[model samples]
Target: MTQWPISDAVEEMPPGLWIRRGAPPPMFSMHRHDDVEINLVLEGQLHYLFGGEPLTIRAGEIAVFWAAQPHGLIDSRTGDMCWVHVPFSMVLSWGLPEAQTAPLLSAQPLITHAPELAARIAHTAERWGEEVGGSDPGGTADAADGPADEDGAEIALLEIQAALRRILRASSRARPEAPADGGGSVPAARLRQVSDMAQFARDHHRSALTIADVAAAVHLTPSHAMTVFRRTAGVTLGEYVTMCRVAEAQRLLLTTSMRVTEIAEAAGFGSLSSFYQHVSAACGMTPREYRRQAR
Candidate 1:
């Protein structure tokens, strides 16, 4: 099987929620994080390789998913995307009914077809963007004064709860089936090994990593680790490492004033040539161009 990289989407943030508005990122490889994620498409379509199945969310739609499942944005024709990341703990605290939370827990993305709700979401996203001082492509929204401020945090939580309830109402007649497994139904032990390896890569992507290091982290031999990761994640361990590095590079490029060379080093690239090669291949543009367009 061909090895594809998987980016990791874990970062420290304010306790309950994180929200951002911007262009959809370049096609990301399969990855999983611990948050429950919502995507509100304002003006274009998003195509996802979600749990190994094809799903397309068009303009004027909102989709929520359990981000712990392997998923990626393989394609997007959208320039305006609003993403809200609510921690699982926060979701649990919302006291939503079983029917409302069951599908997401089971990995089924609850998509609402309410155009009015989409507009409301977009407005909330704009307010959030302003609250955080505009689009934060790197997901770090003013760490000094983020949503943790009591008033802003409370408003965001209330807005999210209302939005979710509205979605539950809209989806009553069209609830989707549980999402299919993304990793070809592997054994639980193998899944844990792969998850561990993926998390390790995410945690240490800023440093040089090797297959042997990742294998040791998961207490498996290199070859056996590779086999398990491939069978369960549909990607090789090496590719996943590269994906994490490239993703960090993209984030720095779009969100910081750091020079390209600096970003390359900070993102764990061994050489400027490799950094340029990977960035161009992933984003279809040079880092400078990407930054300029993103701004």
Candidate 2:
């Protein structure tokens, strides 16, 4: 197995709606981001460790998961793959019918084998990678370029949603349901602001981040930012930032041989005690216990 060198870019944060295609990077540290990720295996098989659970996807299979949960490519057989990351906030704003959104929001990935759709998704994803300037297999190019234009971005989003809906349509566990009226729409401005704020938090959580900092990034007052973020995202700004920290700690605990104190600092915890408290509350186990179980 080959472990690809971790780039500084990869260590920082995930970019908005991005696509990349390349040979499988056999080793990856556990990491999470606020996105709905779609992975298409073009050849061979790929194995993953997601939140301590094992998952495998073979050629011609498409797997979609909420990337907010910790996941990584722990191992794999040689293969080419395409990866797509859609900002979760943007996905939420789309008001996708409950049936489509439910499966993505859950911890388990929605995996489907459809060789027919494989070619189409690959072509589309490749085109997206080109537009975003992220076609490099090593993932060195910056994906923050996003779409060349707003129109292009919207088209990409529509196509991705359609692909997901089609996959959901083929699933035995899904049911037909209309999108809820109130849940079906959000103002474009509100969506953009909330997405920006959420993305800012994800990008800066490994620092001394605060609600005010998040609000400032979006040019909104702290009070208004908190209100809108809570209403739109269904989570408090503070809670969201803490969630990011806890996730980072979990990843480091299981994937790296770092001491608990070192991991706490790396994950942006203010103190060792605070790290222990949050990790226990989030995982129902101490850091040492969690690491021991993984071992």
Candidate 3:
């Protein structure tokens, strides 16, 4: 079978957020990550197939959505963008009002129309980029500061919280008409099955797993599970499993000093040859090379 296109996992960075500045690539397949994603479009626009529904964010707009849902960027007219990934745990810790949190959790992106906030967003992105690039020694200093001045991490959290509030206010005031296509035609039961199976695979990818095992987790037969997952997710069970393993391997390679062989075994590869083959195919580089380039 042809391999399915799986989205790469977003690694968690310090301060419980990952920030990047770039244009989003067109996604060949739907992908999900365990983070709350915020996108600030600096130029052009972004088109997304989010949960089988079409959504668009124009230039200068900030859109925030839960990354756990199956979302894909099928097209874009944007040349520049800033992406922020906040861990779900951090989002919860922010204690956002239910009005803002409910929509995000329900797969509804809270889009802001307040152009006034654009400069602040840009500055935040710039500061984060500097910190990640190691241009500022005091970048993480806020993390160690007391409650008064706060650390950089604490300041970031507060800024994000304030942004959410502003977004919530903007959404309420605008009351934009809902999109014509609310979502796709996939039945809820089928979606639940596929989501359950995918969650299972993500949770257990470090251990030995199989299609049958995934099916059993959702109490479905192997054939039924395969059909439902493919229909809803557009990926085969085995392909999804491989994607999970490869993603874990990538994380380990970038963040840890563990030996390649150890990382291979830890990421659920049965043999070194198999690990090398999968990592090379997915990343276009051997493990050592990937680590070097990533670092």
Candidate 4:
């Protein structure tokens, strides 16, 4: 275990994608990707020293991490790793339909470790293989014989997002009333800050609250605030707030008979138009549709 560097000039992730399995006993030189990274140990335990913290991920589990964080994994037990890297821009764009990506781009990160994500990942990887390999099962073929790499990559990325939606939906539904504890209170303090800000957002999302307002409460600069919020909790401050309000509205929509406008206002919407826009954007439909689906 050695220290890898962080906070470099090449901090931003570029907009391309790559996926491959690690060859056993091969430890790539210690370095970070220029994008967000997701790694799952498929067949054995993976010992990782990341962000100066010791973490050991077992088989059947997954891990999402910032591409900028210093990290490395080795197989003392099996020396094997399976991994995927997606650019931050790609992830934010992928989070929404292609037509609506501009407005949804976020300056944050996302990470998770759930066993259920594995199957979806395997499906994506298989699609990638077919889309790139051209499926001829032929012995000899040129690079052009494969499907266009760009198209194949796009399909794979979309599948990754589909899996993420399921995982995130389950997560939001099972969101703990309180934040969990770990990460040495270093991250925990920021997590608590995010929780406090979330509570505020839940109560005041429609109030024209600004990033500055939220950052002030937590003693971080607005730009810095967004980074801490996302890296710590896997969503942007704005998205987090929006998620809280919409989730509350969902609860109200399902449990009570309030009209959508009233429910929106109660959930911190300043106007029916904004409420409709946000709810529709977060989900693919209007509040009425959301409520109907909830039922």
Candidate 5:
């Protein structure tokens, strides 16, 4: 298996990596990482494949993706991936609050991950994205072109990490809180279907997807299957699977030096424009800009 893509734009902060500017979409097909990554999409839709599911990450989304596991995106509808990507190796070395890291690394595939906090991080990244992607980032009052300010950029990263911690913790508590029957005794037939849907995403996020596709995997109606997906997992089926795809795409971009177009295709992006849009929206920077800045 290919190793995760490493952003050329990483700022060495001891053992941790502060990766900015990611390679364009279609960056990597399948890969793994040495560090965990967190992404706050600031632009369009980001599709991720993880743990046998396809998760769609859209603008105004805060998601925690782990590199400890293999992941990548096969496709994206958004033009560019605009967001913040952080590696877990940095989190462990930084010695920041676990309240900051636990929630994100939790067992669940995905969660709110601190919705409000994520929103705040999104705002900061969006500001940086607009400036960084600008023709003249330096012309602005905020010092747009000269690379993100030392204070502002680091703060944004901290906030993103902290929020993930919050989300992870909150979700963990919820598992205990779940009604004894929440998981209930899922019929073996339904259980098998859910398993199959999960497998389908793991095997086929690059192909075209629809609710029907997942539902059919279990021999159920799309609506019924979606209901099952949401009940078992807190997120909707579409949301769950999209998250997986986006996770996959992000890892590929960070671990390899592949061109955005190549990454986008391998990641399963239907089109370059869509790949850029989703990757930008998810990572908070265009693929080219991500690679350039990562350097």
Candidate 6:
């Protein structure tokens, strides 16, 4: 076995979005960052200690997770892998349904096996690796494709998002959840309500939204709505709402010149103190510090 590298302390992942194709590195420490991380194992297998659980991602499998949770590469058979890190705030901008967003934030790795999509996914990753100057210690890029243009970066982002959606679909199909309704074949009927409640939260997070308002949007009583959402999403409705607001604040801090006070209001935080507390908890830094790190 390869010797473990360096310390095992959790380190903060630097801010930004990036794509890379390379050999898996030896990691002895668990580290975290606030981004949505996707990994495609092209050859051999990659092992990880993710969120205090041992996970093995074999070839042709793609794993997705919230990087905010401490994770590290523990072992690997000689293999090539592609990695994509999308800022958490940017993922919220995608406004994906709760069914999809919930798992990413759940601090658990979502692994899906889709051999049918492997070749295409690998091709896209190679393209991105070339375009973004991804550190390619593995030398996996196709020589014929050459380097990609600046515009390729934007296109890569869209393709990555699409790939995530596809992976989520495969995951859901693989593990069919029990319906909220007893023994009902159509889980969508109740599941749709959960999705709607999440959408409502995202759409109106900037406003003073109550459980009553979100429940009303989906036509469910507040109590029932909360129950159903927690069961399905593995998170409380209020937690999701706070997630939405924090995501918006992250986006503003990264992309705009707004002051902390203005950003707090713009992102729908009821108070500056509340905003500071949440941002620190989520990003492990103040709004100003997060922006500076990104630079």
Task: Judging by lDDT against the true structure, name the best candidate.
Answer: 6
Tens-place lDDT per residue, model 1, 1-295, is 2122244343243333566676765433555666778888888888775543446899888898867645667567846778877766567666555455545544347787777787787777666644433223344452234544668756766877787767665776554553332433334455456656876887787788889999999889999998877655556788877777776787666445789999999988999999999878877889888777755
Model 5 misplaced stretches (Cα beyond 4 Å) = 1-171, 174-189, 291-295
CA lDDT for candidate 4? 0.53
Candidate 1: clashing pairs of residues: none
TM-score on alpha carbons, each prediction: 0.51, 0.62, 0.48, 0.45, 0.41, 0.57
Candidate closest to the true structure, highest TM-score: 2
Clashing residue pairs found in predicted model 2 = none
Worst 10 residues of 5 by lDDT: 134-143
Tens digits of per-residue lDDT for model 4, 100-160: 2211122222234565566457546655644554211112222234555777656755776
At residue 94, give the lDDT of candidate 4: 44
Output the lDDT of residue 234, model 4. 55
Ranking by lDDT: 6, 2, 1, 3, 4, 5
Q: Mind giving the per-residue lDDT tens digits that candidate 5 earns over 1-295?
A: 2223233222222212333433233434444443455565545566655532345676655566554345456456544343344454445445433233333333234444344555565455555543333221112232244446667665655655565556555555545653333223444444445545755664577677778887777788988988876655446777656665665566556556677778777777779887887778766888767656544
Candidate 3 per-residue lDDT, tens place, 93-133, comes to 56554344445544346777655565467567666544433
User: What TM-score quantifies how close candidate 1 is to the native fold?
Assistant: 0.51
Where is the poorest 10-residue window by lDDT in model 4?
A: 98-107
223-242: candidate 2 lDDT, tens digit per residue:
99999877666568888788
Prediction 1 global C-alpha lDDT: 0.67
- Scored against the true structure, residue 236 in model 6 reaches a CA lDDT of 94
* TM-score order of candidates, top first: 2, 6, 1, 3, 4, 5
Q: In model 2, which regions exceed 4 Å deviation?
A: 1-36, 41-45, 48-62, 65-72, 78-82, 85-134, 139-158, 165-183
Give each prediction's root-mean-square deviation over alpha carbons.
11.3, 6.2, 12.5, 18.8, 15.5, 12.1
What is each predicted model's overall lDDT from 0 to 1? 0.67, 0.70, 0.65, 0.53, 0.53, 0.71
Q: What's model 6's overall lDDT?
A: 0.71
Deviation in angstroms for 118 in model 4? Answer: 0.8
